[model samples]
Target: MATSLPSHPIGVFDSGVGGLTVVRALMDRLPFENIVYFGDTARVPYGVKSTSTIEHFTLQIVDFLQRQNVKMLIIACNTMAAVAAEKVREISPLPVLDVIESGALCAVAESKTGGIGVIGTPTTINSNAYARAIHQMDPDCRVYSQACPLFVPLVEEGWLDHPVTRLTAQEYLKPVFVEQIDTLVLGCTHYPLLKPMLSTMTGNLKLVDSAIAIADQTAELLQQQGLANTQRGMPDYRYFVTDVPLNFRNVGERFLGRNLGAIEQVSLDRL
Candidate 1:
């Protein structure tokens, strides 16, 4: 049903700048593909909001991105994906991809001992989305979940590898470690920014970075659909935000691992 061309940009959106991590992975995996990213910076921390509110905001973003003529839609925010991914799919004309499903699939495949750990925000963990998803794929695998509410702010603050971060991670992961999990799913997009520190602390535990998993999945989907960009020149990247919060540029640049070019702010009425 999609008449989208290979040259069309892919739309990726999140509650905040965390989705930039997904964008970074996409840039690495699909170098020729253009991307349009939207961050709902004005009303971030969607974790605390009601599901209906989250869904409403997500649909607004989906509507905005659809106007960009994107070939596909990617829900980069774990909370949004958990709450409104199906709703997005229902209305979207393009193929929809979500990080939660990708992360669950990757976690299931990567876990050697059928023991997997999951770390996410309180909302994501409380939703039991990851556990449900993992069980749907592999009912025999044991899922150990922990809610690390502090990781997001820590990552946004750029405290990666800091002593305070290390201590916080250790304390948060103690319960999961006790379960003896062989793979740890980074359920929050922001958590991927802490991969180096998490990897260092967790040693041999495989970390399922949803960003990388979704990027790989997107590449596969693009190839199968014959929508992969054939040209090799520089790809266009556009960023949209609801509001420019304090230190947003700095935090977003860290998450994206590069300079954010031009960021356009859109009003809610327009979204």
Candidate 2:
């Protein structure tokens, strides 16, 4: 008898729809691979949660994905990626990818003045995940970080280009602009939706989207491991959420920039 070939899908999770940004990147970057995404919407805004709570939720999602036979895992939320990535790696049998390091590396590689600004949730900023990663790669680099706790709620509420969002972006980024930084890291996954406003506020600064960087890294790793799906056939993508609101389809479609075929609501207990 021949040995069985692994036919598992890629598992991606986040605190909420923010991770759909990562999914969009993966779909564009790795068209052959199938993806399974889980959004913990009932527990949205993981940024304010305790480290222990985030870790526990992360593990539960990873375990659930393992049950679905995921070949690899991507922690798409910045808060969870910053605080619980290591713990998930310890228990996962598959390769685990996180967003913080990839975004940091990209910022370091693209910065010319050695000045980098990072914006994320309170947890991500307070943890200094981006600052630490950038400094480790280049200690001479100046790292400025700010917490934009409102960005998540704004993004979640689907207010990307609202006048209020523009004002909020200006207010939050004023300090970083004063420092004359040339690189800005969208440390939080949700922040990418606000990129247009952020760009307007930051002038000519280079904006780094962690979702894009991580997607690139994911492609390279899969190819290096000889696990890159070689199929040219249509790949299936599944979306699941802990709590599906009436506006989930509308909000998710906007976030993903495409229709989410069908979203199934699952209990957190099931995970």
Candidate 3:
């Protein structure tokens, strides 16, 4: 998002706390940039919701973030990226980025055998968004997909390495493993939190986390736009949510790898 407005905070949002992983990556990659994050905690799990509803909620958050005067927007929820990115781009004033397309591009580059595995929420997997994006980029890539609906809640609940989580991964990944894919795309933002367990399960397989791709692109865009923040001190990190600010405060730190200080509970209707 190259822009004349270099000081505007970068806006990032998801259906819930999972998007914090993207925020965390941005923090690591662009420590001096300001950030404003909104988690739709009142209505979590956008993966199960209908496309129209996802678009509605997404636009509401985008409107709210636009009011904050952000220079860029990142759709960290894979499901929303799959179903709602076009609408988001249509309405957003700033540059918009999504997780699915980035991961697909990365998978195509990282895969050695042209065999790639994708795992995401049922809505995301059922949509076949990753496979399509991969094939569009490289017609020879073989795509294997699985929908792990339980992974979101499991990560939110902080069951990162629990046996139940491992067992669940084992069961869900059985088919993908059979495809002999060399690269696995963690299609959902929430799946990154389960990295340790997933690493053990998909041994010797390269894991493609969309956060890296998104962060790299964000930095590249910032440079291209001459909007890179040049300040050196700690930058502002403010957070807002639709509901349960405290709950997000509790679970969000794990996703963010730091305390989410002074979260504001907002009513989108009021905004």
- The collision pairs in model 1 are none
Tens-place lDDT digits, model 3, residues 177-243: 9887899999999888888888988889999999988998899989988878887778999899989
lDDT of 2 at 233: 86
TM-score, structure 1 vs. true: 0.96
Clashing pairs in 2: none
Model 3's alpha-carbon lDDT is 0.89
lDDT of 2 at 111: 97
Q: For model 2, what is the alpha-carbon lDDT of residue 130?
A: 85
Best by lDDT: 1
The best-first sequence of candidates by TM-score reads: 1, 3, 2
How much is the lDDT of residue 247 in candidate 1? 55
Cα-based lDDT at residue 248, candidate 2? 63
Candidate 2, after superposition: displacement of residue 34 in Å? 0.1
- Please tell me which model should have the higher TM-score, number 1 or number 2: 1
Scored against the true structure, residue 46 in model 2 reaches a CA lDDT of 89
Note the Cα lDDT for every prediction shown. 0.92, 0.87, 0.89
RMSD of each: 1.4, 2.2, 1.8
